[model samples]
Target: MDIHGRQLQSAKQHQVFVNFRGDELRFGFVSHLVEALQRHQINVFIDKLERIGEDLTNLFVRIEESTIALVIFSRRYTESRWCLDELVKINQLTDQGLLKVIPIFFKVEPVTVKQLRGAFGDQFRDREWEYRCDKPRTERWRDALASVSCKIGLTFEKKSNESEFVKIIVKEVKKMVQPQENYVVVPFPGIRRRRDTSSHGRQCQEEQVVLSRESAVLVQENSKIANQIAVVSMRYMDIESENSVIRAQLGELSERLQSLNSIIEVVEGVVGKVPEIPEFLMNPWQIMSTSSQPITASADMFYYP
Candidate 1:
């Protein structure tokens, strides 16, 4: 089956499957019951009015998928052959433990349905010959009726509040329904136990697991190394910025040295403008103690005289 078919086949799809007779119950009581069940958020599948004209094959399929079968044994239930077939199916599934049957004797006494007397008997009596040659089928239907009526179930009084009656049935169904699950479980093929694994296969799986862990560690280490490289690059950029500042400072210092050279040249030109001192005056102390000073002074006095 495809995914949709499998989903429809799940018992969880419809937790409560309702089976009832003709328009008398479906329009009157069953509608209220379905509404109450829906109000309580119960997933239910009920036969539509037009279901009488259409094919009922899918209805049985829905019945099979449901976990609970709610049989409404009204006055006209035994009159419908379709209803009898549904009841039989419900009984079979109940016997197999796949479905739970909750019978509601709607305005019909449990004794009436069980003994096939009163309203239930009159309805079946009219159609008795339809199943005379098929006694086994009629017997199946009777057995289904007996089994369902014997079960502990609720009864709707003729003049009582039907809303409250439906409430009781809804409560009972809710009590029996499993919790609704959001996810569907897809079936898997069967497998052997762990003990069936060969030693070599086990060793290979272990080695693969180790390799997976090592790969994760390697990825983490690579991330750390990349972060370190980024930090180093930022520091390098900062050092380059510092080197540019130093270069600018050096250029300013060179300009200041050139300005100092210009000031020294200006001072030397000012000194050159003043009178030149004789080399003998520069060595005056030594010149006074030598004979050169006296000879120079005698020549000077001779010239002046």
Candidate 2:
């Protein structure tokens, strides 16, 4: 329920968000798809727009803005952390009903991606070890992979014809991007003409106007509620941030306390072995012989400074 960061604003600009690994899909399959979509006048967003030091917030915004996402799952897709992160975000948007996802498995089986098997499994295992300390993130990545791979999508095998596949994918994308045509049902003209129903029609129109007004009021109320939710989410994020800081500080304090305890133990051990006073330190006029008496556990020499 708590939205943060990019969730502060709504995106209503782009049409399609292409989520793919640049190294594997950029030059070949994704390129062709982008060109085909562009040729058809579709507003497409690809990672090619990404630059050095570009804020990743832009990527999320683009994904949110897009009506549909084309997630091209390639063999090396999981190898790139950015790709995985994008996939997670895409899935999040999809779950929220903010975006539709059409996954395209390229040179990788849907089962392999879903189960993290074959080369996908290999890379995933390596990444798991690499991110062993961040298991939730890894798990989210895996979940995203499973979620997307299970969706109905086009698949391109290693030996599959690229051009033919691109054409099919383009056609599919076109179908998604195209607006649905509204069909009006016309009554048959063979029926006899009825008497004028002006009064009834006027009453129906009046009822429709009342309903429209009520709908508008409901919409406004919903908008207000959404705004209130956003404010609460921001507050929650601030609280979470403060909690994290407090936890970190507490951890530091706990470590410092342990260190102080160890230092105290060392000092105690050294002090417990109370040594006899040196004869040289005794007053010259009042020479004192070394004490033959054993020091007791309650000796004053054991007192701390």
Taking all chains together, each candidate's TM-score versus the true structure is 0.54, 0.57
Q: After superposition, how far is residue 276 of candidate 1 from its true place, in Å?
A: 99
Return the clash pairs for model 2, or none: none
Question: Number of backbone collisions per candidate, in order?
Answer: 0, 0
> Residues 153-220, candidate 2, lDDT per residue (tens digit)?
98998898998998898788888777644321123244323333499855655665576567656754
User: How far in Å is the alpha carbon of 138 misplaced in model 2?
Assistant: 1.0
Q: Please report, as a residue range, the 10-residue window in candidate 2 with the lowest summed lDDT.
A: 183-192
Error of 1 at 207 (Å): 41
Residue pairs in collision within model 1: none
The parts of candidate 1 lying over 4 Å away from their true place are 1-12, 49-53, 178-305
What is the TM-score of candidate 2?
A: 0.57
Which candidate leads the pack in TM-score? 2
